[model samples]
Target: MSKVSLKGLLSSRGPSALRSLRGGAASALSDGERLAMLDELEKSGLGWFWASDAEGRLTYISSAIAERLDVPLADLLGQPMTTIFTAAEREGRAKSLSLMLGAHKAFTGMAVRATRRPDGAVLRLAGQPVFGTGGRFAGFRGTGADISEEFHREEETARLARYDSLTGLSNRHRMAHQIDSTLTAFRAAKRNCAVMMLDLDRFKHVNDTLGHAAGDELLKQVAERLTRAIDRECEIGRLGGDEFQVMIPDVDDRGVLGELAAKIIAMLRQPYSLDDGRCVIGASVGIAIAPHDGVTCEEIVRAADLALYAAKNGGRGQYRFFSGELENETIFRRRLEQHLGEALREEQLFLRYEPIVDAAAQTVQAVEAHVCWNHSERGIIDEEEFAQIVEGSSLIGDVGMWAIREACRRAVLWPDSVRIAVNVPVPLFLSENFVGEIEGALTEAGLTPGRLELEISEAVFFGETSIVDRTLANLFKLGVRMTLDEFGSGYSSLAYLRRAPFDSIKIDQKLVAEAERHDSRELGLVRAIVALAGALQMDTIANGIESAPLLAVLSDCGVRYLQGPIFSEPVDQDVLEQEIADGSWKIDPGAERTRRARRRTVFRKIEIFHDDYAYEVTLRNLSRTGALIQGLANVPKGTQFVVDLGGGQLAVATVTRSSGDTQGLEFEQSLVDDGSGGLCTRNRVSPYALASAGTPLAALAPGSYQGMVGGLIDQGGAPKFGYAPGGRGD
Candidate 1:
């Protein structure tokens, strides 16, 4: 190695610097002797010395250091220093090592990496600018010490801090930091982002039944699947336990987000093959878009959380988009949960059995027990309330057992030919007293065990399966009829059917709806399920057959038990007793030939745009495909308008039916759920779109559009149609 140049600095600083450069003993040595000592130091491996010419290309480097880098000293001599060493990001003393060199200034302890080393060696460099005889800049001379060991230790520590040990995905701290920084950076750019929050449904059941190790494996599999399912760029993190968060950058369309959310849910719902056994769990997704939901990480995460809770309460296995009403809905659900126990105590909880008629005989062969609540404040609480309050509450076990006993008590009074199928929640089915509760219900009612069917979902398989198998065996010995509910929905297993003693299998309602929708492989799955059930000597039950065409199709596929609106809605015991008093009940299916979408009654005011004019109308009822509005007069069939359903939700609709001042509208684009039992357009009119019209980029406020207002009011245009005169109806 060349001698570290000290003569230029010594001449600049005079005798004091010379004395400082050479210690008392070394001062007696000549310049040649001092250079010899420096050469010996460079030969040692403790550290290496390097000198670059004015062009920043390496002129002289220790041959020992070149050996470590696995390059010949001659090859490194002419190469740029940047090619050999690059600044380490962890120690950003300068933006870059090249910058300090460009400034011709001194730098010390700047961490760097060896570019060609297979061992990934790290080095801490200290350097100062060198000058020649004329005081003109020459180049740089630097000393570098190996720091690879320390650097690796710190890097492993950081990896542990930022990643989950189980899933190897980002932990909570990393997720929070990434979300915060991304939102802060995107704020000025006005770019939108979406966050999806998910938690495994019945995940606790898995932990309780299988071991925690199995649960860990399931989480790893879930993380892998999540990584594969996302086609776009995203950051997925596990926020502890079964909860996960996905931050998708630069996407705000509810249509796109909703589809992605649904896709994630579907992927997560698939059965996981683990060491324990086949475990099937579900996921619920709650999404929130940035700037609209919140501008900060905490706000968006909280919003997504609220939406997730709503999805769980609404019944698991669904995705819900966040809205302003989520907080209120959450509070309402909590209140209902608190009152559910009282409702049970006061006998407000009751069962309504929807008859499952035999497809071939057209006779009521069995009825499924559906629980309903009679809340004093809400009059008659619907099934939605029951799902959000009763089933989701801590008292699920108590409510579930009560329903079993009550259904038995009621079924005992029914005709012997008809059976009663009661849904068994996973927690209650796994409870220690589960078998005893069923035995007690049967004994107290003095009902035949075979007449009371226990409809168990596949989630029951996710728990300590030995106990589950024992429970099933005991129930079988007790002669309690068992039906596998929603078998083909997610947990599609021939092993469960072969091992468990199921008297029948329940077809998922989705397949039935799909059969009504189209002639696709979904129907093939149904036929296969029916065929398999037949070979197993088990009957098949198809639920949610709402239309005549669906009923005919299911009948052709050999489904024995049929239930849905095509027959009748769930009725109270009194009505059932009256219908089957003569010990025989047969009913005709409805005359409806095709399936129709269910409409939600919503009497709210909305705006409709026609030919640049806005008309105020009262929205009577809304569905995914259509809505009814009554306000403007003389709007004939085939007329088109843009309907605004608030929150920037706009749908282009054409009038399909017309009456005096009342018209039925068919939406070109379907609506999506707002997580609050309301319908909204799939895609909203973005504020960025408004910016093109000279409006500022911001969140859409709750009101009519400013552009629409100017055109409707300032133009002095005549009214398009005469408004209905106000009377008591207004």
Candidate 2:
């Protein structure tokens, strides 16, 4: 019967099938017969068919339709199809029916659940619309099928594809699509947007300690927290393990983006309770805004990635924004790094020496060696441009060591009295081989420790005092004098001043220039520093004394050493030696002598003793009396001590006060010991020594008697004594 039914359907092609089902051929069928045939067909198969008029009223329904709806055919026909459909299906079915009628074609795959009448048995409908003869819009008919299992299977597949299995949130694939679409819309609208890529810092630590399951739970919780943190205007997506991306649309102010980044950082900083509240993780975020950081998707992603790298480099638990300056700086640094390796190998680097002069003495006491690079094509590259790159690399230590060695070698060529002060990078000081390098340089150059002063910027003493202390101690043990460079510009910790093994401090040029302006604050600061340095027994070098007024001011402040362009520009070794030879390089010796005299006058006497020797020292005159006594360790009290008064005169001294190692003496007698008694006698004890008999011993180095009794007497004014004792008469 099934085969006969199929054969009948196939043989009666086109509209003949409908006509055959009506009873016979189209010419023999009546309308009543056709309707009766449709009813019979519905009873024959599990499928159902329905015919609706143009107005959507059912003119006829198969018996199967009545069975599917659990109703009689009479009750189903001549009724609106809406009665058989749910609210959603009613609209869908109506649209399908209208489309099929308008197109005058059969429509299929209209699915719905319908209840049979009386018994109320449920059936799934998959139906099609039917066209009348000559392609006229007539009615709709289709089959009903059971598809409950199929519907669930399709939904499960979609769920797995779109969501993260662990967090139930949109995964990377879905988020990427969403981001692309959103960005396209933003671009079309000419609106600005931002993309933030975040990575959880130290997330692995939690996973390793708490297991992968706990890690999964933590990620789930993190997703929820992040979603809650963002506003509805933003979309958050998980870009796989420990990384997330957020898209912010219609953003106006970048500050708001920064604020959002800060907020995210803050939120992430809060402890994440996982594994029953035992695990925690922090997050770092990098943000890139459109039309500024980048224009296209790839560019934005790359910018965000760079920003992320910067954030991680800056340290975790923070956020950074993409900046054009940062990008340029990064590129510049990379180029510099690439060139720096070759620069060292090619010996493109050289040293420039700036003389550290004693302003009062007008002598080059030391030369500060500064590093300079003469690029083959770029001409001169300033230190500020590449200093940071050098500092952050291993090259800093190597370059610093090289500087020390070169400076020492050059220093050995200078006068024995000239010291070379080499600037040392802080990292070099911390290097384990720093001491060895210094020793090697010293040995190679045969430079004395006293002549090799290490000038360190004040920044070195700021961190890890113990390390600085140890480094200073090691340098001191090597007999290397330390000078604080750029003194006032740095932290200038008083504690470091007291603890570090520093022998001198160079007043920064800024302070010195300000002091020259008659700036009270600056001058006062300089004075205070000078006083402090004096108290600490540290030598003070006033740097950047450019103007004569400033020099005068420095002199008044009792600054003994100074270096600047006003005095003498930094000259090459040959020029410096020529200047020294010409005697035109003379500085005012009077100022330095005056300063020393003042300092000496303050001290009563310095009785230095070696072993069990003692000498009674007497202060003759502060301006000219020699500071040292030779027989202080052996001469007895009350013995006629004939002191050699330089140009062949003898000054007799008697001990007046005697202590264990110190003694006070008085000039008791004077005589010409050159076997002559005339004024021109080679040796003569003059009245100047007698007049200075009661003076304190401290004034001896710069005493007036020596100035008067020296070989050449200044007879322009009051008759100065000839060859007075303790003067540079010889």
* Winning model by lDDT: 1
Assess the local accuracy of residue 116 in candidate 1 as a C-alpha lDDT between 0 and 100.
71
lDDT by residue for model 2 over 1-730, one digit each (tens)? 0112322332434454464233345456665565555556556764454555666666555555555556665665676666654322321233443444456455455444443332233345443444457876555544555344564455457766877777777778877777677767766665667888999976886777677888888898888888878875887778789998888886734456656776776566455656544544667888776644555777777878787765664445567766544566567656766687688889887776667767566777777777777787767665433454565565777888878988888778766777888878877887777777898899999999889999887656533557778778888999989988766642355766877878998887767777866756888988988898899889888875555677789988877678765655445557666655543355442333222211022223222211112223443232222222322333345433334333223343444554443434444332211100011112333323433455332233322343323223222322212211222332
Each prediction's Cα lDDT score? 0.79, 0.60
- For residues 587-656, write the lDDT of model 1, one tens digit per residue: 8885754567778877777777665556778899999899999887777677766777765566778889
Q: Which candidate number maximizes TM-score?
A: 1
Worst lDDT run of 10 residues, candidate 1, spans: 709-718
